[model samples]
Target chain A: MKRGLITALAIAKKDLQTELRTKESINASASFALVILVLFSFAFDLGREELYAIAGGLLWLVFSFAGALIVNRSFARELPNDCLDVLIASPAPAWSIFLGKSVAAFFLLFIVELISLPVFGLFYNIHWTQNFPGLLLVMALATWGITVVGTAFSAVTVNIRLRELMLPVLLYPILIPLLIGAMGTTTALLQGEPMSGEAIASLRLLIGFDVIYTSLALYMIEFILIV
Target chain B: MREKAIYLLAILAALVMIPNLKTVFMDLPDEAMQGAIYRIIFIHVPAAINAQIFFTVSLITSILFLVKKNFVWDSISVSCIEVGTMLVLVNLVTGSIWGRNQWGIWWAWDLRMTSQLMCFLLYLGYLLVRPAIAEPTQRATLSAFVAIFAYADIPLVLMAIRLPNVRTQHPGPVLETGTMAKEFHAPFGLGVLAVFLICTALILIRQHQETAQREIDSLRRELHSI
Candidate 1:
C-alpha cells in the first residue's frame, strides 16, 4: 500500500511536471473560466439580489465546463506515441495511475476554481470572504467529486471516436447529482449561511457521492486500462 | 422454437393490450381530478415501469458479460438497453403530454421529472457510446462499464422522488392510494403485463438482428482478407 501510494504520487508528479512545462491545461481552464464569468455577466443583466441567488450555479457551471477541458486531457495526453501503453506496461498498478490522474486533476481544477472566485466576487460585487471557510470546503468537495468522475470518464472516452465530444456527453449526466449538491451548498454559503440544514443535506449527498464513485473508479480502472 | 416464442409473446401482449385499451377507453370513467388526461396513465405508467425493468436487466447482463466475457451476454445487454431507451422516450413524451394537460405546462423541474430526464439521457449515452468503438470486445466492455455506471442513477431517481425536501409534481404510486379506483386496477395490471411482454419481444428481436448483423460484418471482413 505504501509503495502504491508512492507510485501514485510519482505518476501525479510526472503529470504535474509535464503540465508545468506546457501550462496547457491550467492556462486553458483558468482563462476559459474567466471568459465564462465575463460571458455570464453579459448574458444576464440581473441586479444584486438575483446575482447572489444564481452565483453558486454560475460559478460551478464555469468550473464544470472549464474543468472538463482539463480532465478530458487526463488520459488523452497519454495517447500520443503510446505513452498510455507504456504507462500500463510499467510496474505501476492501474489504480495508482487512476489515482495519480485524479489527484493531478483535482489540484489543477482547485487552482482554477480559486482563481475564478475572486474575479467572480469583483464582477458580481459579492463578498465571498465572510463564508470563506465554508465556501472553500464546498469547493474542495465539489472539485474532488468532479475530478474523480471526470478522470475515470477521461479514461473511458479517450480511445473512442470523437472522444473530445463524447467525454462531456458521457460525463455530465453522471456529474449532475454532484453538481446539485455543490450548487446547493455554495449558494447557501455565498448568502452568508453556514451549515444550514439544506447545506448539511447537500454535503452528505456530496460526500456520499464522492465515496461511492471514487471506490467504483478505483475498482474498475483496471478493467478499463487492460483493454 | 425461439421464433415461436416471439410470436407467442407478441400475441399474448396483444391479447392483454386490446382488452386493456378497451377498458381504459370505454369502461373506466374519466378520473375525478385529471379527467380524460388521466387515461394516458394506462400507457405512461406501464412504459415507465417497463423501461426501468429493462434497464435493470441490461445492467445485470452487462455485469454478466464483463465477468463471463461472452458476446451473447453483450448482445442481450445492448438489446435490453435499446428497447429500454425507446420505452423511456415514450414515457417522457406521454408524461409531458399529461403534464401539459394537467399542470398547464409541458415540463417541470421537480425532482421526479428532472431525475427521469437525467435517467433518459444516461441510457441514451449508453446507446450512443456503443457505435463509437469498432472492436467487438472493446465495445462490449466499455458499454458494459457504462451500463453499470449509468445504473447508479436509477437509485438516485428513486431517492429523489422520496426526498421530503425536493418538491415533486409527479403523483405517488396511484395504485396503492385511493386516487386510482379499484376498477382501474385490473386494466393497469394488464397494461403493465402487456408492456413487459412487448418489451421482452422487442429485445429478443433486436438481439437476433444484432447477431445477424455481426455475422454479416465478420463475413465481409473475411471476404476483404481474401
Candidate 2:
C-alpha cells in the first residue's frame, strides 16, 4: 500500500512537472474559466441580487467546464508523447496511474477555482473572505470527485473522434449530481447561512459520491488502459 | 428466418396489447385536478416501462460483451442500445404530450423524464462513439468500456431527479403506487415483457446478420489479397 501511494505520488509529480514546463493546459483552463465568468456576468447583467443568487452556480459551472477541458488535454498530451504507453508498460499498478492522473486533475481544477473565486467576487461585487474556508473545502471535495471520474472517462474518450466535443457529452450527465450537491452547499455557505442540516446532508452526499466514483474508477482504469 | 418469425410474433403481441391499453385509459374516472385527458397514463406508463426494459437490456448485454468478448455479443449490445434509444425517444415525446394535456405545458423538468432523457443521451453517445473508430477490436473494446461506464450514471440520474428538492412537475412514486398501480398493472407488465422479448429477438437477429456480413467482408478481403 505504501508502495502504491508512492507510485501514485510520483506519477502525480511527473504530471505537475510536465505542466510546469509547458503551462499549456493550466493556462488555457484558467483563461477559459475567466472568459466564462466574464460572459456570465455580462449575460446576467450582474445586478446585485441576481449576481449574489447565482454566484455559486456560475463559479462551479466555469470550474467544471474548465476542468473537463484540462483533463482532456492532459491525457491527450501524454498519449502523443508516448508518456502514457510508457507508464502502462511500467511496473506501477494501473490504479496508481488513475490516482496520479486524478490528483493532477484535482490540483489543476483547484488552481482554476482559486483564480475564479476572486474574479467572480470582483465582477459580481460579492464578499468572499467570509466564506473562503468553507468554499475552499467544498471546491476541493467536489473537484476530487469530478476529476476521478472525469480523468478516467477523458482518457477513454480522448482516442475517439471529435474528442473535445465528446468529453462533455460523456461527462456532464454523470457529474450533475455532484454539481448539484456542490452548488447547493456553496450557495448556502456564501449566503452566510448556518450550514443547515440540509447543507450537511449535501456535503455527505458529495463525499459518498467521491468514495463510490473513485473506487469504481480505480477498478475500471486497468480495463480502460488495456482496451 | 427464425429471427424474422420472432420479430413477427413480437409485432403481433404489440397489436394485441393496444386494445387492453385503450380500455384502461377509457375506464379512468375524471378527476378534479387532471380531468379526462389524464387518460394518457395508458401510453405514458407503458412507454416508461418499455424504456426501463431497454436500459436493463443494454446494461446486461454490455456485461455479456465484456465477459464473452464475442463479436456476436458486441453486436447484440449495440442493437439493444439502438432499440433502447428509440424507445426512450418515444417515451420522452409521448410523456411530453401527456404533460401538455395534464399540466398545461409541453415539458417539465420532472425527475422521471429528465433521468430517462439522460439515459437516452448516454446511449446516443455510446452509439456515436462506436462507429467513429475504424478498427473492429478497438471499437468493441472501447465501446464495451463506455457501455459499462455510462450505465453507472442511470442510477445517479434517477436519484437526482427523484429528490424532493428538485421541484419537478411529474407525479411522485406515491401517485404511481396508489390507484394508478392497479390501473397500470396488467398492460404495463405485458408491455414491458412484450418489449423486452421483442427487443431481445430483434437484437439477436441483427447480431447474426452483422456477424455474417463481417465474415463475408473478411473473406472478400482475403481473396483480394490472394
lDDT of 2 by residue, A1-227 (tens): 78988999998998988898989999999999999988886687656776667777887899899999888875787777788788889999989988988898889889888888888888777887786777777888999988987898887776778888878877777788788778888877887776667677778777877887888788867777876
Q: How well is each residue in B1-226 modelled by candidate 1, as lDDT tens digits?
A: 8799899999999999998898889988987777787999889989988988988898899889889998899999999989888888898899899899888999988775777788889988888888998877788889888998899866654543343376667677643364666788899899999999998998899999888988887898899999
Show the lowest summed lDDT stretch of 10 residues, model 1 chain B.
Answer: B155-164
Off by over 4 Å in 1: B157-164, B172-179
Real contacts recovered, all predictions: 0.32, 0.33
**What tens digits encode model 2's per-residue C-alpha lDDT throughout B114-195?**
7877888888888877777665667777777777777777776665555337676766653475454465567656666656
Worst 10 residues of 1 chain A by lDDT: A200-209
- Sorted into a CAPRI-style docking class, model 2 comes out as medium
Residue-level error in angstroms, candidate 2, position B3: 2.1
Off by over 4 Å in 2: B1-5, B11-15, B18-36, B162-164, B172-176, B181-184, B209-226
| Model 1: per-residue Cα lDDT over A1-227, one tens digit each | 88989999998999988998999989999999999999998899998899889989999999999889999989988989999999999999999999999999999999999999999999989888988988988899989989999999889898889998888888888888888878877888898887878888787777877887898889888888888
Q: Docking category for candidate 1?
A: medium
Top candidate (DockQ): 1
Model 1: share of true interface contacts reproduced: 0.32
